[model samples]
Target: MRSAPLLLLLALTPPLLRAPEGNQTRIGPAWSDSRNPIVTTFSGKRLDLWSLRPLTKAPPKRSIDAFLGTTNARTTDKRSLARRLSFDLTGLPPTQSDLASFTTAAAYGDKLLGRRSYGEHQARLWLDVVRYSDSNGFDWDEFRPLAWRFRDYVVRSFNADKPYDRFITEQLAGDELVAGKPKTAADQDALLATSYLRLGPWDNSAGLFGEANRVRNALMNDLVETTGTAFLGLTMACARCHDHKTEPLAQKDFYRFRAFFEGVTFRDDLSLALASDQEPLKGLLVTDGDKPPATTHVLAGGDLNQPKEEVSFGFPTVLDPNPVALCKPVREKSTGRRLTLARWIVAKENPLTARVLVNRIWQQHFGEGLVATPGDFGYAGARPKNQALLDFLARYFRDSGWSVKKLHRLIVSSRAYQSTQSPRRLSAEQLRDAVLQTSGQLTERHGGPPIWPPLPDEVLKANPAFLDDNKEKTKSWYPSPPERLGVRSLYLVQKRTVAIPLMATFDLPDNAVSCSRRTTSTVAPQALTLLNNPFLTDASLVFAKRVEKSPEADKVAVAFVLALQRVPRLDERRLCEDLLKKHGIPALCRALFNLNEFVYLD
Candidate 1:
């Protein structure tokens, strides 16, 4: 039997060994050698890829404006600047009093950056990059109830002004940090931070042969891809199947990088003792399973079943040629691979991490980054139009104790950031929160579990998978109590299969992949949602009630200032008054909500 199979293999091999034709060389079998051909010598052009090169040092006192040569750029008026700063820092529109009392841009920027709302807003942006959701994604889409602990942790981290490098360490290796015994509330918070590993979509359903391995590989792949795009701004998933087509990343590099996470497994039974209240709450986190890690191999064509030559733990060879030494903890249940990886990521010698972070912050404030592609720093992505400015920002970020608030202050104080620019639409969360704040309906509670706001009957009916059917009486989707409906949009439950209708209309990103920059689309549904959605209608009614006691002329002025952050002109006030008399204050409120000035930031 062995001889017969060997003869068959020999007969099949000859076809691949055929004589060379023309200038083409003969090719070998598909799996002849599992190892990819390594190219150690990169050309000068390849070495000069902007993001991959070492960071260029700058003088200690150089300002952001000096690098951009934008010192002559004109600043916007105080009211517009106040509104912009409020939305940029806190994701909320300025109050009438806030606009009235606005002083210098720097002072106002510092004030907003210090608020609790700043953390909530920044957490939402960071959550988008990590694909954080409250449920498993695929067909089953089961809920992950304790996931909000991680969300709250992120909010607290930002508000406390935790160093960016420390933030990276906690999310990547928080469980390892408490490997011996957790003694403090900070240690417990570290455990919650490990939930970052479990944020991606998962499939709970069983499948065919080798399905377990397949699901595990899918998860590992998501972790590696998310880590790359979220921290390094590289499209590493492109190298999983073969050598990356456009960049220097290789197939082996992908598997070796993934090997760092081979020991990780989910742990949901852990309890965190809350600092606010001494009660213990169940938490979702990741831990290294109590066993030696399985050896990882380069999968032929990225298939779990076609595993090839085994690879060891290491960073991407393109980023650093040295190998990492893993320290196995004798007293703990971990390989310590993740901690090593995390340290390397935030190390001063690493080129991509700081640059990627500052670029994302710039994108949030300016509607686009200096490098237009926030997540891709590969050969295929856009090169920074202002490399000197980007380098200066990156160096300053790392040197200033990796402080995000300091970075925000530095950037906002620049003429480049404060200058007048074309108007940009509010993000989904900002628009929703602004509507609630304008109507005086926004709940000011900080955090706990996510809340389920009311969804349209059609939307609920469409997503049958969102309901739990295992119980005797099938549990259907139910909105939270009426009081909680007014909470900020960040607290809304983020089900993978069912998006809140209004948010979906305004382009809430699908939570299945890392989203560095959200796509802004102009469509009929956006207008229709604002005009016809019951949430907006109810908000308008509440807003009308707030201003109905005032005189008609005063009502128009108050409404305009509240919604648009500026006083209404004579022509606008006259038109609004006519609408107010004919259709009532609610009608005028509804019309204000639909205005370009109300929903857009200038």
Candidate 2:
């Protein structure tokens, strides 16, 4: 007689092989069968022609406006739209000429999306989703020098507009996808994307948690949480202790999902590192090599000592009722589990992957997702305010070859994106980068070891680990030497413990978990830091110098245009002129930089 497990597997296999139900596919609970939203496929595929028919019928803007209601139709002018597109796509304010030349919001958005800077901006947004940092976040905070390689890969991937499915696959199973040694740049890039696996804050050092297995388990949790939130957009880690309170996920589901990572190992292999000045450090990989892969067991109460029955590699059951049966690999390897999982995630039939990704892109553009909880899409999370609009955008994103820049153009051209009424505060990175650009100190040069901006003397004194043997000077932390000083804020050295104080004050998410959305708050420290931070003071001085050297006869007007992307109104001009008379160019410049118009996008 066949074993019980074999019988179960055989019984579960047929549903996965079944043809699409009517015109669309669905997974229950996560996605119900009755809700048939149009999905896209490639050329010659049955669904591809139908996908283009919608675009031929109506533009993305009209469709979006219709969904938002007639009262919300486009009214904002091109100038405001240009400014919005510039900041959203390139993370910088539009110049006077940039605003002047804009004929339509769509044209300017297209231009901005084509720039290399667009990818850099996209990379910064994705980094937050992946919990990326240059160093581990524990007390030690030892640097992950090679982490920059992965960061660079993300930027390049966006710039190239690599298909979203390929991006997900590479990040998950790039080690398995590449052949032999990774000798060429493309091969190396594939391996580099796997750095996503190693990115979450970890401390593998002995005695950090008193038990080696516990630390390993914690690392596994990080991997589970990152993968779930970043790709699947569900909080799978919530089920580690027990059944997920709101979702269909169970503790056994967590281990079964985790089994894909069992053979993965960390090595300091330079063969896969991107070419750079500094020596590349640890690499993430999977190799069972002669031995069978390790077994995974559900830890009762998430306690290691209380191990339960062993489990096999599988997808989450909510996505596929027979998770194990759904994982039939086309190209098998010794530890091909991850490759199978990666393929399943990008499969067109899976309801969550495209939806989650499109939501994140929406969140980055608009400051909040339609579903307010960007990372959590479970029953406990906030239901999407506009599910129809969300589904439409998700289908469009997939139909468009998962081109991020295309998504940006579609969203930015919408009446909602063009409107100035719903203003978003500049992110911590955007705020700093804007100051640098306004002061003419911003650097567009991308990709190198992370740079550290200047911190207060007291901060360096308090965090001696960042300082050289002579406590007076910083060792690995260097804010100057000119070239490094002007790099973008996203590229700033992210020592999780010693984050740039100004950024921390402005609410940089803690690097410990997958941050779905940044919290905006009104606080005294935020005000105090903006008022007194030396970086701002120095930028103010630079701003004054740049304005002083401008060819324009009206220096105050020049300063205002540089800072706020527009000439000051009569009242504003009078205030700046009075300050200029009393305190000089620096005072006028500082006041302009601090203006509400300068910090909040409208």
Candidate 3:
């Protein structure tokens, strides 16, 4: 005999157990232990999931190519290699001079890694994974003015080549890293890093009932899901409603993992003095809300109204069978749950973090990770083609002081990395920045507040509320000054309601959730955006002017080198010359910008 609530839950069970139209078997409900509901264990076979097992302890290999078991991988041409290295490291095309002065790939990679542009480019990837945005996502999409500091902090961390373990610790528990108020810029940066916790889309609009609890639960869910995907490479959120269908995670595991963040709440009014001027800067960060955490429960069907058994702070049993013990903080301002969880994630014994991070770096360079599904290293995710190589890189990354730059050097120096492969489409930011760079109009400015570039009238009218209504300036989108507009697209304001036209056309992630990888789509609008967008038109004109400075006969070769980082082939030279003669240099430049070669890496 079951309790009335349990019977009701059975009746209200979600469609997860229902059979498909053609499938005869109906899946059963998730098993729940009556005596110890939170202590779920997996079968031996389930525990053997490759990603769930401990990382291989094989002796370090001499070279990455050695793991591939290929002695003679064909290297790309020096020109293509130079272009690839430039874009992979710095998200820009190589200049005309770069093609002529090509050196060994290792030296070029090291030089590019040290540039500030490397941080700017790498930070964009991190921001996408964390879903950084300038506005709250739901209706009334209010602006978050101080969120840009987190963006700048990420850029600085990458530029400094911050250790991966410390990076994880800071972002996850930066608010708790310091005892009292932040005194130095380093302390302020730690607090700013905690902004990663608050980067998910938020809804704080008025007039909603149960808004407080609803918003809190939604935020916690986001935090748990993002942290799991971003750090553990697991789809832990799938178990929220019931046990995960494929993975070993139980519903109780979701609640238990979430309990670590049960006390987190936003602190929007933190005042920290800047190291340069001692000026007070307001901070937006996550904290323990200066109160004891509420009890976390496994809600029936993940509904807040139907809370079941309470769960405490613990990791997934599949990963760590032993329960984590919490220590009382000397200062009672925080529960210290996040710091504990952060340390556990970066612990040497943990198999997922270093592997996941190394896979991401591999993905950035090769256009696909060894594990193709970066965020889902679970039963259903694609298995790594070369597990040995993945393990070697993971071990190397961890043993080398967890230095991302060192890992990058090891990877890009490998013959496996430099070998010719499929072309990768330029990311939205990369495309925009490349156009500006080719035009010699890129501002190359360091971090500041996000810029708002001019939008087409149609785009503005599509979201009329984003236009200035005279009553509220904060709710509107105003274009930055012309001088500032040429800054890299990574610095552009990301409004949830109104995406920049060119970015949306080119598949910018919406920032609604953590994006493991951006989808690449070839569509008519992308062509239209490239040809007709005012920014592109302006850039094309600027590029034409730059090309016109060359001798008339050499303009085609000059444009090819500037845009594609290669000399024009005989056939390409003739076609481009005819086009250049028919229309002005601007039209020739526009045509070059629209070419697949200009927007992809060989």
Candidate 4:
């Protein structure tokens, strides 16, 4: 059977293929400004065009199809519309197959949502919210060698349309809740479950207990901070040290937040140490862990060891203390602190949880959330364009019992999500690969361990050569080779000293901290990746070759539809013909592959 990501792809509507509406807030059909919202397409088979909507009522037509109406509809030029969708969803262009399908679909106005390729495109957005990473990034470089196990779990989660709440609970509390002493298949993904304890920027050069505390603290902090912004649209970090100086949080609340992970500790289960955190447990308890809390004190400036005053954690003022206020979780032998906090966070009445999550889903599809900052919802942050709508969404999230995939279906089913104005950011690596697969280029290698993809020279330098010293004969490097191609980004080892330049250039987080939103930079270095990088060049060659060999259309037309997602403009078509004449079809294809507009989502 096809996998979950594949399944989701099959369920989607391509970003480029849409039945237009009138007076549109969705940008693409109109192509309003150069700043028009990015409509994401996950290859042609899967697009998020039918996913998001701001209102339930009948909405406006796509700009391209709206004013053009029946009078000039067929005659009006659609060169720009096609190009936008191809780049946004597929991350590649229309191929001969795509052109024939989209051309017929657009003309006849049929329901274009049922192919396996479509849902895979939508899966791209799911990867980002989880902060999926291959290697452990912090002072410790490669301990998370096989953490791709977690990445695979994520891919499977989205592909299977795992209910969102179940997804969150499993990731956050899996190891603790799963049954068995050593973990079993019947144990509800225990090895897969330990990943819950594995999220965040962790380093342990300090000391085991202290380091465990640190990682635990860091995870808690990340849990609070990212969860807040990612799901609630609130800047909860400001409340950490003292209180949110601006947002509705208070100092006591931050401590109450810290109280959750009061008993978490990390032990590298593997001393064989092939750079993975694989320490065989002498009886390593993955969850419901029994540990001792040394002390609780107010760090004068946030230094854990340094204490100014004896302090106990409490709930934030912005948040009602009722969740855990009455029943204080304690630890004589075990700390129920985290369980208390998580229950509170996911509680049905918790106003911000569902709201923030829904906002993220909306943001994924629309390119902008009702409240723009996403993570930081404070007085100083961008005000919600539609507060009532955000509230409605949040309520829906809670009432739905935090069903993530169902939300996907709901949002995608909306006219807004389906609109051409899909404001896209990167759909994480899995999403990117899934789209590739739908386009018949994706490689779905299931779990074993993480594999490293090619990286720029600088990124390689920063990453420690993952080696086994005792064996002495040979040691395998995690990132493989710097020049390798066709490897997925998820397999690349993360380095604290340096990041994959292409990812960073495209605004990927460094993994040092929790990043809820990435800055979409249009800098020169990013351009260099598209223009000069070997990967892009190779991929372009692959894209070009795919188009050239495919029948059913002229080579130029096929390339434009497949690679660029739209037909070429008269001028652009002329330029291609000129490049072919001046140099050769190969040279012309190379030139077209290097265009700035081709790589970036508009």
Residue-level lDDT of model 3, residues 174-269, one tens digit each, is 888876777787788888899998888777663376577788888899999999999999998888899887787888889989999998887777
Instruction: Give the distance in Å from residue 448's predicted Cα in candidate 1 to where it truly belongs.
Output: 0.8
> Can you tell me which runs of candidate 1 are displaced by over 4 Å?
1-45, 207-210, 274-277, 327-331, 466-468, 472-476, 550-553
Which lDDT tens digits does candidate 1 get at residues 1-602?
Answer: 01123234333332312223452343322112112133332221243356766677778878888888789999988888888899999999988777767788889888898889999999999999999999887776777777898999999999999999989988988888885546677887788898999999887774554477778889999999999999999898988998787776778889989999999888776666555656666686788888888899998889888989998988766544345677554327787888888987888867789999999999988999988999999889999978777889999999999999999999899898889977999999999999999999988878987888887777776776645455532124558898889989999999888888899888899999999999999898899999999999999999988877656658888888778877789899889889977998899999999998888888
lDDT of 2 by residue, 304-326 (tens): 78899998887664334343443
lDDT of 4 by residue, 404-522 (tens): 54554555444343334533444335223423432345454444454556655554454444332224321224445434334455545544445555566676665654455556655
Candidate 3 segments exceeding 4 Å error: 1-45, 206-210, 274-276, 327-332, 467-472, 551-553
Off by over 4 Å in 4: 1-132, 181-186, 190-194, 208-224, 267-285, 292-295, 308-314, 322-335, 413-442, 456-484, 551-553, 600-602
Regions of model 2 farther than 4 Å from truth: 1-62, 70-72, 207-210, 273-290, 321-334, 464-480
Q: Is candidate 1 or candidate 4 better by lDDT?
A: 1
- List the candidates' TM-scores in order: 0.91, 0.86, 0.91, 0.70
Where does candidate 4 have its weakest 10-residue lDDT segment?
A: 37-46
